[model samples]
Target chain A: MAKSRVLVVGTGGIGTMAAYALEKGGLAEATAVMRSNYDAAIKNGIDIDSVQWGQVKAWRPTAITKNVPDVSKGDVAPFDYILVTTKNIPDVPPTVADIISPAVTPGKTAIVLSQNGINIEKPLIARFPTTPVISSVAYTGATETAHAKIYNDDPDCQKIGAFTSPQVPAATAAEAAKRYVNIYNPTGTLDVLYDADVAKVRWRKIAYNGSMNPIASILRMDTPRMRMSRHIIDDLIIPIILEVRAIAEASGVTLQSDLVDVVIHQDPSDTGFKPSMCQDLEKGNLMEIENLVGEPVREAERLGVPAPTLKIVYGILKGLQLRVKEEKGLWEAKFQSGNSYE
Target chain B: MAKSRVLVVGTGGIGTMAAYALEKGGLAEATAVMRSNYDAAIKNGIDIDSVQWGQVKAWRPTAITKNVPDVSKGDVAPFDYILVTTKNIPDVPPTVADIISPAVTPGKTAIVLSQNGINIEKPLIARFPTTPVISSVAYTGATETAHAKIYNDDPDCQKIGAFTSPQVPAATAAEAAKRYVNIYNPTGTLDVLYDADVAKVRWRKIAYNGSMNPIASILRMDTPRMRMSRHIIDDLIIPIILEVRAIAEASGVTLQSDLVDVVIHQDPSDTGFKPSMCQDLEKGNLMEIENLVGEPVREAERLGVPAPTLKIVYGILKGLQLRVKEEKGLWEAKFQSGNSYE
Candidate 1:
């Protein structure tokens, strides 16, 4: 069998780690798409110090390209899987799907959404209806501390399954999921499992992302400080978890009963782990607000589930995003019906 | 008759303006209690650049005392009124009422709470049972841009009313309210009017402080930017105002039907006004969260009013306060049960 061809969209920590894993599996050739760190990555490769894979000095993928469209120009085979590991900020233009659309081959290329958010695959599925879409949830702790320097302390583990639609049949979607899992986990030590119901896993993951991420961002607190605040844990965090759980249940996904407590104690009490949203706010970067909080809030509204906590939280996150946009000169006042406040 | 003797507790902008106004009226002898600004105030008095009263330099009160106990040490008659113009942060030790208790003569001194908050008079009234309590809301644009330098742009206006209690009769409370309005507005040009129902005024004021103040602090946006964000005004601010109105109604305070609209448009849309709480958060100072949002939330709970907005806003404000406290090294981890996330 010919070796599978894989394209990685974002060259952040996750993308770099995923490319390394696919290349180490020996069944796939990984081409990393680098934008900002292209010079450093092409010259020095990537220096990774990970707990799972220790002391990887200057690891480089099979191929490197500056743009996505450049990949499909020459005589090249179709990419079997294109993993999008970018931040899921949907409000900004040229979304992840749009950026990766140029390289996707309809009905051939399976797109994997390896990001932190719910409803992240909708845009890709809408753009390429016949293409097999894979929904994935990653549980690795990977970060690029400096240019081309990656630090991944946590183990590499992820759950991926097919996102079926009318255009893609269930069997085909399942086959695509199984093929990508096998290609990405040839050593079987990467813990890349094929989940039958990815939506359930997404909802279960949202029980934390939808609650803790935004709360920590709003409060500018890490996990340990948040856990130390009794009033916050009981009043704000728990109620928000219940709201997310209620919305999940209304959408036909029943989260575990003790899910609230589990989410609270998921991390150890002393871990000073800051959520991505909190870090984004601190760094004045755009956050994954729309997919992580906004979409679920709209879903709750549509499902008639009372999500007061979600609404207030989404409103706050939106306001914070506006501040970031204003600082970056990206905010435009869109007026409607003669009201400026809108 | 001799001029009425008054001691102003806080020498901030409001207190300074109050002293200036009282002395300008020539009906009260004002003594300002200064802490950090005591040296500057005593040596140079205060520099004023005002839109109402243009360019009055080095304006000093009758007497400047460093401490409250020192004011009552000499062979001086008891103070007729003790104006507690301090920030109303009750959660911190040695509250405003406690600090001013040494100079307060029970049944002789009228305690004035010229501060921003709802239910501020409760503490003072509790400290002095027979003493008349006055609740005053300030509506002036004043800020101390530098040490001993004051800037007052807007006209000085306030509403003075008696906070009646079981120990103080309505007639006596009414007399105290009338006497305060008279003394505070001797020129009759300063818009200090007597309000018969002071609780109604407080609830009306809270429709703004309890909503806009905290929301702006959380979002870090001024009035203009907040008014520009339609989502914030329509989704967050308006909903919070409605919640406050509901809580007020449950407490038998019939706020005006157009109170919400009035609160929204009270400030012009183009003005860049930052509320006190917003300023406090930016300057890393203790905010008036306990009285401004906490008390109203407790009231909503007590009256069976569904105030989800208030509850969530209060929780966020508490978390922010914790951040400030931690920065100042004032937070204590009080463990109750087994869980620390409390």
Candidate 2:
């Protein structure tokens, strides 16, 4: 029997886990691609110590590709699943479309975006007009401690669906959603939810993303402080959440109003946890600032809805990202510290 | 003619300059009180390198006092002027009243508050009802370089008046304002605007402090990035200004609508300037978070007006301050960092 082929791009903590889960579940033969940590990941494979999913020791992928061209074109077998776990930033080089293009093997590929933020699937969908694309929202307390090594205290569900932007839950049929869920669910490693209301779910996740990611990152503090901060929740965090809800409503998605309360009072988070944005910031690496903060803010602004909290937060995080990227020289362009593009 | 005695408390960068300006201005026989930099200030006097104001080398005070009692009682003549320059954090002990109490010698002393934020004079005003109190707004490009030295790039106006909070600008008559101005104006170093509308000006300054101070501090960013942040100015800063204006109007002062524009665009805040809040955070010292961010937020909340931006920013900053203060353990009360009282 031939195992299904899955190529996971952006092999950080999230990608590593998805690859590990897929292979361990006996659902597919997974391949991973890495850039800087390529040699380490290729040699060491991935080691994730997750409380929920027990232990996966040296779970190497079936194949390792250094670059996207290798994963997309160099491989003989067409990938059944192409998972992108990188940040979805606009304008920055190597757009997700560019990275995932070579792997779009028509009938064979199912482009699954298991990244953060909302409405991100549109651009990738636009690029691959005919290819089946799946939007995913992964909730896991996971962070990369070292090359190919992740330490997760808690693990949560990953929601996936076959829906485009402005597409509501009712519009998205269950066939692709079921197929996407089936790929990773058998592992019993994670709670995989087949989401019909992916737009709402994405927006719901974004409510958390917009509130937690940038604010926590900027404060350089973690979830415990943020969750316990009545002031932060009542004044800062909730307003951004509500604003996201309003933006969603304006865009004709009826999100559950209690989502704000859910995000605020959630446990384990109250015990203090750092989101990926904060984690990346602490490491002085580039953050998903544009995707998590900028995109929603601009979207709300475009819809004539005012999201003051997100706007300012986005500005601060953008400044931080620019400064970090500049200092780390992670990318080509450099901005002088304390200076901006005037 | 006998010299009029002046006592200056809190010799940080702001306090250092005010002491220098008072001495160099020859307005009074100035005595200074310092906690951390007492010996340095006593040995070196105060050195100020100014962009607008000329140099002042070893500008010694009439006397240097370490404690308020020393300044209030150690000096021979009664203090005609009592200047307090530390932050006004509520319930933090050594409140503004505590710092300037001994000098509140009935009519013999005129209490002057040249600190940042709004209605800071209320406590001192309440303590000495009969004493003439002056409120001041100093616009200076200065940072404490050495123990007793401040490097000031620009010397701007010091706006002063004698009025209580909720008092309209039109009601302010500036006899006390004039006298206070006479003391600091003789330096010919910084421009001194005897603001009749000190209420409006203070509110306007709060518009800046409430927005820029906490945001920048939490982000650990400075003015150029903060200023270059269009989203910050347009979305975060402006909304806060408007909210403050609404609160001001609710409190019976209709601030000029253009104050938002002025705060966002007009200030000659030197490039790469870090607000006092940011400076405080960097030192891991206690911040004026409660006063600068908390007070107005609570005030707005009390006034039945929603100040979402201020509330959230206040929350994040308060968290940062609590965390920093806990770690520094400058005083006894430890806020279980990352733990909420609830």
Task: Write down the TM-score for model 2.
Answer: 0.84
Interface RMSD of each: 5.0, 6.4
Q: Relative to the unseen true structure, what is the C-alpha lDDT of residue B146 in candidate 2, on a scale of 0 to 100?
A: 75
- Computed on alpha carbons, the lDDT of every model, listed in order, comes to 0.86, 0.73
What is the per-residue lDDT of model 1 for residues A98-171, given as tens digits with 9 covering 90 to 100? 89877898867899989876778788778898999898799888889988899998888899999866789889
Worst 10-residue lDDT window, candidate 1 chain A: A333-342
lDDT of 1 by residue, B1-342 (tens): 789889999888788888888888888999889998899988888998888788988888999988885336666568989998888888888888779988887768888888877777777777788999888888888888887788898888788888877799989988987887788787688777888888888899999999899999998788678888778888899998999999999999998998877888777655577888999999999899988899999999899999988899999999999999988889954433333454
* Candidate 1 docking quality: incorrect, acceptable, medium or high: acceptable
Cα lDDT of model 2 by residue, B1-342, tens digit: 456677887777677777767766776677788877788877777787877567878777778878776334555567878887777776467688876776667756777787877667777667777777778887766777878887887665677777653332323425656776777776444577677777777777788888778777866877566666566566566777788888878767787767866666544344566778888889887788766767787778778988877876776677677677567764233234433434
In model 2, the Cα lDDT at residue B295 comes to: 76
Please count the clashing residue pairs in each candidate, in the order shown: 4, 2
DockQ of all candidate complexes: 0.49, 0.31
